[model samples]
Target: MFKSVDLKLQLVELLISSYANVDLSKVKIIGVQHILETTHSMFRSLYLLGLKPENIAIIGKCYSTCKEVFEEMLDDGIYVDPSSSSYCSHKSYDEWFSLNIENFLTSQIDDLLSGKYEKILVLDDGGKCIKALNKFSINTNLIVAIEQTTSGYEDIRYGCFNFPIINVARSATKLNIESPMIAQAASERLYLSLQRKGLKTNKVLIIGKGAIGNAMKNKFASNMEVVCYDRNQKTYDQAKVELSEIINQFPLILGCTGKISIPFDLHSKISPGTVLASVSS
Candidate 1:
């Protein structure tokens, strides 16, 4: 079902070649949770690259769409499922908890204290691991970090950290090349959802004019009357006004903004049967 399996393999090979001389067993990995099979394959490749099974930790997301498959694929590493208790608890670690907190930090600190790893590598999404680190004092060496989402980068951009973080979220390869495909896939899915409900609309309102929003606007322009509005575009365009004025004008509303594009007060202004979809995290 994953279309990017080949590309994921290429990434694995690139990582393997890049760290060919380094001892992977001495490196501690902290990564984000993802549902795609391609993400699972990437973790599996890392295990095969001689990184200690226990050294690799997969932090759980706020919600899991593929927990069973993830656990089955990466059985050796520390599996931090928010729904369960801590797997590898430490006496010194605090008892903080949340829906996505599965004691990931505790286990990693325990391993570090036991002299299991000399360096830490963070592969994060939405800045989950970075936020977790801010909660406690980590005395280990953090070498390098990679964040692959714009929201995640924004979260850590102003914050102080010991390591150099790479922002793959705003990279040319992701924004210029991959975003349009993502928008296309999202549009196709939205189309299918509308078809299943037998809903038809002549007008669509897009809430953000960023990469995904702009691509989505183009995608729907040929099929329906599309209107795109962004906070940044209000300065020059007359049509780019507050959402409340045009909230009921369109039968379909799509939120391309990663944050809350629509507030609670505006929800009452929307048409009764209008479909709302968000293509962003």
Candidate 2:
């Protein structure tokens, strides 16, 4: 376990390394998590990247977890936990959460404008928080937005915030799971795991024309008799395969359309033991 002083030094070293290589003064990050585990991971990554504990702010329900992590990492004056709650429970908390979240973010904005911090990272995609930031016209040089849900992205995008936003969607691929390495590794691991369980030659059906679907198709086509069903006529034409033919021919299916609807009568047409996988955004 990394003690408070050790972690703080590590963070400082990481930041110095980053600054030496790039520009640290230009980077700021903010994030929120509904779960403790997710929050831990996000903070760990950010700290390891050289962000000071004081420069970071979190606004969510899990105050206890944040406190523990930050306290363990930072020295006496380096880190501070301003949340009232000690523990994080995703359980219901009447309207207080929303109010508190807004208050916390608004306060942070004040700190930023007072020259307390240069860069800012907003973690939640909540309408109110985004609106608050926008209304105040916070002079944050850089803003990194992290959200777990697709609805959050829509909220921020359509909420009329003019800032440059980067949404780290953790819950769905449509947000954070973007790296080709992670995608390829996940695909390979899933494919191999399925193969080990006597799922080789599983008729994998994909339903999308996007990059992820294409990557899946390219990776799984050689091993399994893969078929793609896409509404994009251009993609269908380019693939040299018809959607109807693919739907009629394959039973084991994988969906990548980012939409919730599953194409074809999966229950009626697919074999009873057929495997189905969804890699949607």
lDDT of the candidates, in the order given: 0.70, 0.54
Best by lDDT: 1
Q: Tell me model 1's lDDT, rounded to 2 decimals.
A: 0.70
Model 2 C-alpha lDDT per residue in residues 85-180, reported as the tens digit of each score: 543355333245556665676666656676555566666644435555666666645554555444456456666565766665533444234535
Superposed Cα deviation of residue 260, candidate 2 (Å): 2.5
- Against the correct fold, how does model 2 do in TM-score? 0.51
In model 1, the runs with Cα more than 4 Å from the true position are 1-8, 14-22, 62-64, 74-78, 84-99, 232-240
Off by over 4 Å in 2: 1-18, 21-28, 32-50, 54-116, 123-159, 166-179, 195-197, 231-249, 259-272
